[model samples]
Target chain A: MHQIKTLSNRIRKNTGVDSIRCYQCGKCSAGCPLAGDMDFTPNTVMRMIQVEEKETDKKLLQSEAIWLCLSCEMCISRCPMEIDIPKVMDFLRQESLKEGLQNKSANHNIIPFHQSFLDMIRFTGRSYEIGLIADYKLRSKKILQDITLAPQMLMHGKLPIFPKAVKNRKNIKEIFKKTNML
Target chain B: MKKKLGFYPGCSLEGTAKEYSESVVSLSEQFDIELKQIPDWNCCGATAAHNLNKTLSLVLPSRILAQAQKNEMKEIVVPCAACYNRLSVTQYELLKNDQLKATVEQAIDMPLNTSIRILNVIQFIQEYILPEIPEKLSHTFDKKVACYYGCLLVRPHNILKFDRPESPQFMDEIMQMLGAETIDWPFKTECCGAGLSVSRTELVGKLSGKIVREALDRKAEAIIVACPMCHANLDMRRPAIDQYLEMKTEIPVLYITQAIGMACGLNERQTGTRRHLVKVIGNYFTKTRIPVENNENNPITVEEII
Candidate 1:
């Protein structure tokens, strides 16, 4: 458990609000859809706040709860204390990223997978699945990681070698040119 | 006549979500809201890209923004929540990081204008389309619905600042104007496990299942959504969720426009209600409205003509 003095002082400094308003009500935890999956429940995080223990560690940040949060703002809505639980979780995720404490689960391939998807869009002015998947596999340095899997997907007619492109790639490229964040 | 917007429809609207695009086009036409589909629009590279590379993830939408700047469409109307978030976050990053701007621009070969506004369909409707609805409403939906914003509609970034992100009533407000009963439920903007729907089925099933259960628990006749993925995951994936949870939840997850169309007295066929996975509008369409297809992608056929 976090020390009360440290938690209050941090809350006062960062949130510009006193942590004393929270009366250990579990409404936030109760309403949070991701709370059941969370390693640290909303109530626990709030309690930690009262105790003045603010741990921004890998375990805390990398936990599935951090990413699984839908940020629906339900917890705060139901909370009598009006604590922004989702915002706090977002802040923790940011701190975790800054401190390089991100959890890279086996499913961590998603991040790079997304990069490849973007790369295809950047180059072709739209999504090109074949290009994206190839880039993804290449970037991840997983040459034969899913070699057999690819054939299975192809056999199932799920994989398309020639992904569709937006008609007027050049005009789209011009749009990309103007935004400059391509 | 030309409504200036960087139109971001994401993956669903472009391909998998053809009905959403069709309805948006149909409704936009009725209101004369000229939506210039961004020339050469690309995938916003949703949940997948951001997970792989942060820069690439951000750059995907930045590329769209760059195009928007070129076209001079400062205000981007995204029909999809994931796309809206990507575009909004990219705009935030570009305004925040000059180095990132330079790199991303070089990659796409575009000079981003930086003055871009990402608006979701609901925001567009509330800001531009809703007020005009009173004049357009031809019918009324007395049915009670839970306006589910899901996760991406408003959060992290306030692109669509229509309502409180945690407790958004923007959809409810619109629903009220259209003469529908809006239920103030606890799971208004809850996550239906949208992003993980493709990658993690069981997890998304559980998440989506819970959202439906909440709506059913609240006795909402339907769930109105702005995000297509939310519609798909919650509505289309209901059977799986039902099996997983071992409960029969026949709640119809409707698009905000679909409900609005109903209230406005648009034909069920025109609103594409017939194409919905779960039988929606039940027997309501028979006595009130005739079926008509507003085929914007093609021409309106006589058979489709009501």
Candidate 2:
């Protein structure tokens, strides 16, 4: 929870908007699309900051609620004094993760697909959908869960069984090699 | 007289989103511009790169920057929002930090080329193409469109300066050039949960469906986007979006270029209209890639490619 102080201090210095200005008006919560799915609504997040309550729910860290914020400026725009609530929330999420607190709501076991995606870009400087999907299915077990759907996708000509690589993979790879992204 | 810039098509041009890319390229030709494909240009480590390693995030796009610099091109035009962000952000980081420049150049084994411009196709059309509008547009796009800037393009505004991070209008300006009515909606620059789409399909589906619904409720004839991922979500994933939300949303999502292409008298095929998932809003387009080279006097053709 050391990140709480870090997040608060950063918000105060950076945004210059007092978290105490919020009076639980619920406008932020009323406007949020993911309010029903959140453990803590936007107003609650603001209230949490006001009371400096030690959040018992470590779920805040692992929750996709933080990342799910569109940063649409709706919450801030609707605020009476225009406090930058989304930025404060973002800093909270970033600091929370830095302190080993993560939102489990956002975490999934899709590392292979995610990793293969990066690998494709790293190797060719572009994605090869066929290669990425193949590598993903080869590495992940969940593809079997949806094995029934892949054929259907291919049947519709939606998913090409074979994807073409960028005509100049070397040049593209050089961009990756240069960035150390490869 | 012609303005020429390096072009990086990313994956969409060669495959699913090929139509959108082709139309933009052809549109550029009409503007007296040459979009020279950056020889050996590659992807910019879009949604995947940053998700894997933060380091690869910068490195992947930095490689493309280096290649363009090596080709002696001062600017590179990216049509995809994800690619544009990766390229623009890498350019910003290198220009901002000298140490990063040296380190990146050392990694790519190329001399750093600093002064390169990173422009999204939307920005290019807004800055370059829109000016030529009065001459070309015979019809006005009187339909309402929700201009979806999406996450990668405007977020991290330090990299892409086309518009406000929270409420962007680069696409709006382009839409206006086409004489389309636009709605000032909340989710214009919002994230479509695109990065989470593959792993968390239901979540993305619900979220994307909501965006579509919002646009539809506002009576937008279409949802306009500059990102391929956003296009995929709002267009290709509509079936899942509808299934998850338990509502039908048939509103079409068009790339900003596709709309511009339409106004320019270019048909659906030229704009990648056929590749979209939702029903094509206007004339049906046969999917085909225009040959890289076309004579100026002849109108571009779009033949269905099997």
Off by over 4 Å in 2: A1-110, A138-140, A144-182, B281-306
For model 2, how does the per-residue alpha-carbon lDDT over B122-144 read when each residue is reduced to its tens digit? 66877788777777664466678
Clashes of each: 28, 11
TM-score of chain B of each: 0.89, 0.88
Per-prediction DockQ, in order? 0.20, 0.28
User: TM-scores for all candidates?
Assistant: 0.70, 0.75
Worst 10 residues of 1 chain B by lDDT: B297-306
Cα RMSD for candidates in order: 7.5, 6.2
Regions of candidate 1 where Cα sits further than 4 Å from its true position: A1-32, A38-163, A166-182, B1-6, B157-160, B285-306
Q: Write the per-residue lDDT of candidate 2 for residues A1-182, one digit (tens) a residue.
A: 35555344555875476887887889878766566667788887776666653453344545556655544445765576677776676566555556666555443334455668877765655677667766776765455544555554454345645555566666556655554543
Candidate 1, A1-182: lDDT as tens digits: 97544534644664455556778878888877668876778777656656544454335656656566555666766777676665565555544555676656523643455446656765765565456657866776666654554454344233455656776677555544544435
